[model samples]
Target: MNALQFIETSIEDGIGYIFLNRPKQLNALNRKMVREIVTSMEAFDLDPQVKVILLTGNGKAFSAGADIDEMANDNPINLELTNQFADWDRISLVKKPVIGAVKSFVFGGGFELALSCDFLIAASDTQFSFPEVTLGVMPGAGGTQRLTKLVGKMKALEWILSAERINAKTALQYGFINKIVAPELLMEESVDFARKIAKQPPLAVRLIKESVNKAVDLSLYEGMQFERKNFYILFASEDQKEGMKAFIEKRKPKFTGG
Candidate 1:
């Protein structure tokens, strides 16, 4: 594949990495950058070697937000013609987990992009906000929905309406960010987390991810049924047999994603 202009892609230890590469522009989510992100993620989804995907910024800020200069003059018709949001939707369709390791100024679309991940690990200095309201707009991405689902309407509205910068600790308190580490240790900790999950049985990992994401939208009964079905389905997998047999033999299980 040709070298990407807006992002960098790499694979290591069963983890696929997407680094938002526009550092000087604060890694803003522009059309080209978003396309690269979607394309890389789709590629990783198809690659058997990639068990997990990690998304983070390449520089000082994860992202300042989307490219305002590119969108400032847009109207409904132009937006409709582009169908710009379809690219964002592609992130959710990915079968493998995508972890967001973010820091610094994660605002507006950056905050929304982070939410698109399966989970997040942030640096202690990270600050998140949905400042689209300040521009007489609102979060066109998942911010309003995911954030509200995360911390409830009260906190979501408070932050969105005020455009308040919610610090890392507060975000942790709200239960959006999975963990926060020292700025210098951010990448190390996040990669370690990804590697840990990558070591799990790949079939189980994929099913578990599918079950959990379904929990967000499905009713409790439907979600439980979905989970139960998956639980039963795993018994038919070779990894499940290996896992139990290894436990009985007091030996480590080796899973081949079968």
Candidate 2:
């Protein structure tokens, strides 16, 4: 499906590709652009053909962050009307797994967007930071919360306070990014990896995503209960029965997402 502007979306091999298409602006996200991205993601989440999503950008940068020009001219009325970050919040509600293929700069809002993804595979030279502090503001999206949860409180504090840009290697060491590849191979590697994930049972995959994401907000015991319930629910799916039967029969299981 085509978004009105800023997003280019396509589906292939069970993988949905969501591209930030504002190359001239380094894919900087204005409100409209952010809305397009959220809308595309929600659409992909509901598309039975799409089991995974690959989010990336089409330019020197994955995204420079929010459109500073748009923010600069905002009045109280327009700011209230825009809802600031209400649309961006919808990204986390996506049930399908979203993998971020990040290159160049992923700053402020861009970093927040990447953090919303289930995992991030970045180019070796990718640089990440939260530069909003420099703008006399702070990350208005999920950056502060998600980054802190991923990298821990001390590191998140340091990064956000200093607005220091870290290379992919450093990000990997900090446990923020999953993998790093050559710039030329970023898309190929990311899509290949996502396709692998797409091969899994779709129902189980969605439940697993929900179970794991709940850990951040739930206590250990509560998280375990949530996991157990999802585990029990999966047994009702035909895929689960087929998977077990296939294992006993020494054959591959064909999942129908039921």
The candidate maximizing lDDT is: 1
Best of the candidates, TM-score: 1
Across residues 3-118, which tens digit of lDDT does each residue of candidate 2 receive?
36888989999999999999999899888888888889999999999999999999899998999988886777987886857887788899999999999999888999999999
lDDT of 2 at 30: 87
Give me the displacement of residue 184 in model 1, in angstroms. Answer: 0.3
Q: Could you tell me which 10 consecutive residues in candidate 1 have the lowest summed lDDT? A: 1-10
> What tens-digit string does per-residue lDDT give for candidate 1 at 15-101?
999999999999999998898999999999999999999999999999999999999999999999999889999999999999999
Q: What lDDT does candidate 2 reach at residue 34?
A: 87
Worst 10 residues of 2 by lDDT: 1-10
What do the candidate models score in CA lDDT, each in turn? 0.94, 0.92
lDDT of 2 at 28: 91
- Pairs clashing within candidate 2: none
